[model samples]
Target: MSALLRKIMNFGPAFFAIGYTIGTGSVTSMIVAGSTYGMQLLWVLFLSCLFSGALIYAYGNFAIVTGQTALYSFKKHLRFGKPIALMIIVGVTFGQWNSLIGILGISSNIIFEMISLYVPSAAEHKYEIVLAIAVVIIGTMYSILLIGKYSLFEKILVMFVSCMGISFVLSLLVVHPMPAEVAAGFIPKIPEIAGGKMMVAAFVGTTMAAATFLSRPLFIQGKGWTMKNRAQQRKDAIVAAVLVFVISGSVMAVAHGALYHEGKRITHVLDMVNALEPIAGKAALTVFFFGTLAAGLSSVFPCMLIAPLLIEDYRSGQLDTNSKQFRIITGFAALLALAIPIFGFNPVKGQILTQVFNVFVLPLVIVGILFIINNRKLMKDYAAGKTLNIILGFALLFAIAISVNGVIALAGQF
Candidate 1:
């Protein structure tokens, strides 16, 4: 039992990567994509994960080689390094905090929905109920942040990711997509439908999240790994990317099977539950919300940390979670996230802005690591080889193409 437990725990950093990437943003985007286009965008999801694996390995290897975090390495090594690193720090931090607002709002709404399932009249007190629930949830996550230990973070994320992945996989089983349609999704063709372009960009934007790659080094450092653990790090990246594909695909599959076939559309995240109850029974509702909660909390924990993590990474190669900066930043993020639920603002709008902004930074992030990893001085003898370079070159082109079209699609909405 102990040996088996150790094996699960060994994928600690992978869980951190997976936990943060496969959150509310990914779930909402997948639901919309699945319901709207019925698995046509699986190609985008697949490519995102494929490149994400390459970027993860690149960023992580750079950190291991330099014995420094990502932003710091860029600051010290590249031309205009300081400004570039600072831009990433600002861009990624802003995007993550914005994501927190949406994550908290969705999580609390789901809780209220679950409560109302039993106490139907709970709908009458929706505002106060959601606010109170948000407080409790945010407070618990803040308390976890205050604990300030990487092991604690890793363990909690493991539980959340496991719960979320298992629950979603079970839900997919309850309402699986057609096997041929699932296979066809991988053949690379976008539907010529109205929202196809936007959903494609969103799938890429959310799954290939900037926070995921930017934050990888810190998580890797937290685990005390270095170049000697190269093999393990490679294994971990693969594990993380594969899990993102499986879990996110399961979500898309569920929406496709449960809602698409019935010609139902889910406009809001809560609509997922409303749409499910009639077809899949209350048991499925409980499981889906449970997974959503896990996804939300897992994401919220990382969003709260990203600000401090990036700032510390920029200031120095080392992380000081016990520092005053960590406390102040995380506290501010928690309170700001609660505001979305408290004021009843549209988190979807904020998330849309965040997603679009992320696409812009995606190319920059890929460019930075590409230059940094191939530098012999910084990497000494272990600069990246030709094969990895080819993969990143393609990833960069993909990011730029997505960025151009994503902005246009988003602009077209208004």
Candidate 2:
């Protein structure tokens, strides 16, 4: 194989990170932010990606140096380790599974919208049709999990992620937003409008995702990285963080160009498609929805894998694809994910709300990693240096601050 191909293959962890991080939740939050607040929240996206990169480096480094999974290390090495690890598993699983509900729901709704566009009469029996579509999506995604190895399965998700990134990038090029306003968005002020604080929280929630970092060690382990591949892991983390910012930023830009300037907001999933139509032309619906669907599916698969993946991490560092615990837990997750689609509610609000809720659980994730990565015995020379320590400190503080805002925003909504 060529050197380029080899380099690409080595960035497996980063590819999975892009596929996980830029999924439906991030896409949805970006769309909402851009269409609703124009470019004002790019600061949140920028900071999240920066911190996410640092945390990914920290977690992947600890895993490679110590040769163990995160929860397993937590259980074995800390005071009250078992309970703490179990609580993380529970907290992360709850946030992730709740995300799946919105993910599957949004995916089903988008699919149904696409079908209705081409086959106008299909809207008559929306419930039955959407329910069937949701089941098929769940089944196909779950079956993909049984594909035997992490490497092979992640490759399939790479296709979905590719489609997602390309569509938005192309749209942004076609109907670009103003560079001045886009530049202004990075100045770091949250909008004072209703849900503005919550939108900031959701943006952080999706970009600096808890699952993305919490599961980083397992993903690194699955990719077979060890101490020898330290440089490769850092480069891969950078690759993942850059792709996340670029793709997600493209989505936000496309939405701002198409909708925000016109004072239209994305109240529905298809509103994005409709907004893009006038600016990017008739292909807008097909192109943007294709990207959105890919984004949604990208997140769905990861959500299915996380609970079981973390559970196994807590039990032992080893991940057996064939284990009964993996199968049973994932199957239950896929089944429960159907609730949103079956109930037939519009999921955009729920999706954003879930993303905001994810913010509250993030501080604990960083706290756990902080303890382990700083342990001199466990990390040795790989222990976080001053730079990484400072980044993680800000990351923890950022998580806590947004989480408080998320709670306030959530309370007002109620």
Candidate 2, after superposition: displacement of residue 13 in Å?
Answer: 1.1
RMSD of each candidate? Answer: 1.3, 1.6
Ten contiguous residues minimizing lDDT sum, candidate 2: 273-282
Candidate 2 on 42-82: residue-level lDDT in tens?
88899999999998888899988988888898899888889
Q: Could you say which candidate leads in lDDT?
A: 1
Choose the strongest candidate by TM-score. Answer: 1
| Pairs with steric clashes in candidate 2 | none
lDDT of 1 by residue, 1-414 (tens): 889879989889899888778888788888877887898889899999999999988888877878877888888888998988888888888778878888998889889889988899999999999999999999999988898999999999998999999999999989889999999999888789877777778778788888888888988889999778888989999999999999999999999998888888866656887888987899887998899889988998888999889888888778777888799889999899987887887655455555666677888899889999999988888899999999999999999999888888888889
TM-score of 2: 0.96
The global C-alpha lDDT for each of the candidates, from Candidate 1 onward, is 0.86, 0.85
Give lDDT: candidate 2, residue 350: 82
TM-score of each: 0.97, 0.96
Off by over 4 Å in 1: 346-353
